[model samples]
Target: MKNLLYILVLGLFIYSCSSTKNRDFNKKEITANANDTVRIANDSLEYEIIVIEPGFNLFINSIAKPRGYHSQSYLENKNIFLVQEYNSRVNQPFNYNPNLYIQAINYDNFVDYGYEVNYMLYNYFVFFSREYNQRFSVPTRI
Candidate 1:
């Protein structure tokens, strides 16, 4: 009985130690991913966009087109269309997956958010669509 008790305690201790190591590794990974954010702030206009989705930074760097590939007007047009569709989905949770369309994006056509803002927004929409397997009414150009 004494030997069995010792073996059981030892096994529990080893199991706990291994689980703690895995938890520590996961914490470090989450911390690293927390830095993966895309932020664009227009202080003059008081307009800002912060994307906290994981893998977006990597997507933009590796998969997305280089900056200036699309003209500002082109980006704006694409963003406008995509935003409308996205917001529509957000509005109708019953129709669309609530998990996928969590919040509506406020995008005004009248506001000139500059090339960089539009560019990032457009790429973000593209990334979101691809990541979630959500398709827009109009086909998204890669």
Candidate 2:
């Protein structure tokens, strides 16, 4: 009983002392204007993107399919890497607010592996931009 009381008090103390700087993700906007454009330069990918009218559709009706649902063990650590990579590579957090037509992706449970998922996401953004002519800029990074 005494230990439990101590633990509860310690927990409250730590919680109260923790910094709140990163807690308000609500301040960030997930949606962008059709005309909004961003330049991305990162180790995973480099590209320029225009937000484009009507936004984007993430899932293309191709024969290819996403990896089946993932188990928690397989997702460990890789989830953090994927989020970090996704956040870094996307001009905005597609993980947070996917573009216009893009479907809500199950980022946590969707992939069999990390690299493939990132590759697919980066290309899909490019594909959406090119196919729609909604976004244009140039050069290349792969």
Candidate 3:
């Protein structure tokens, strides 16, 4: 009985130490939004990025082109709708990427315009897939 008890205690000690020895994470700490900081440390290079809070409009406008302006097709596929609208509605000639219209939805404050452009591209892709010997899935965008 004494020998059996010694073996059991030794086994438990070995198991406990071994289980915790291989763990990857040493420590993790998260600061509150007010504090607005993140810290990570490991064997690799330490990385830290400052948190900046800007208004949504300012952030969007910084990356966004002005409304009613367009970039050429060389940059992206041409937007026929924008071209037509520019021709008939504004009577202005411009060449721009269709993707810009997609980006415009967020910046232009035009929800309907964005949806229309998305629908047009989606249908155009579907129509092309049917006519041509090719297949394309609509991409999931962030």
Give all TM-scores, in the order shown.
0.80, 0.23, 0.21
- Enumerate residue pairs that collide in model 3: 71-96
Mark the 10 consecutive residues where model 2 has the least summed lDDT: 46-55
User: How do the residues 6-50 of candidate 1 rate in per-residue lDDT, one tens digit apiece?
Assistant: 999999999988886545677778876788877889899999999
Error of 1 at 80 (Å): 0.9
TM-score leaderboard ranking = 1, 2, 3
Clashes of each: 0, 3, 1
Off by over 4 Å in 3: 26-142
Better of 2 and 3 by TM-score: 2
Ranking by lDDT: 1, 2, 3
What is the C-alpha lDDT profile of model 2 across 24-44, one tens digit per residue?
A: 654443344323333233444
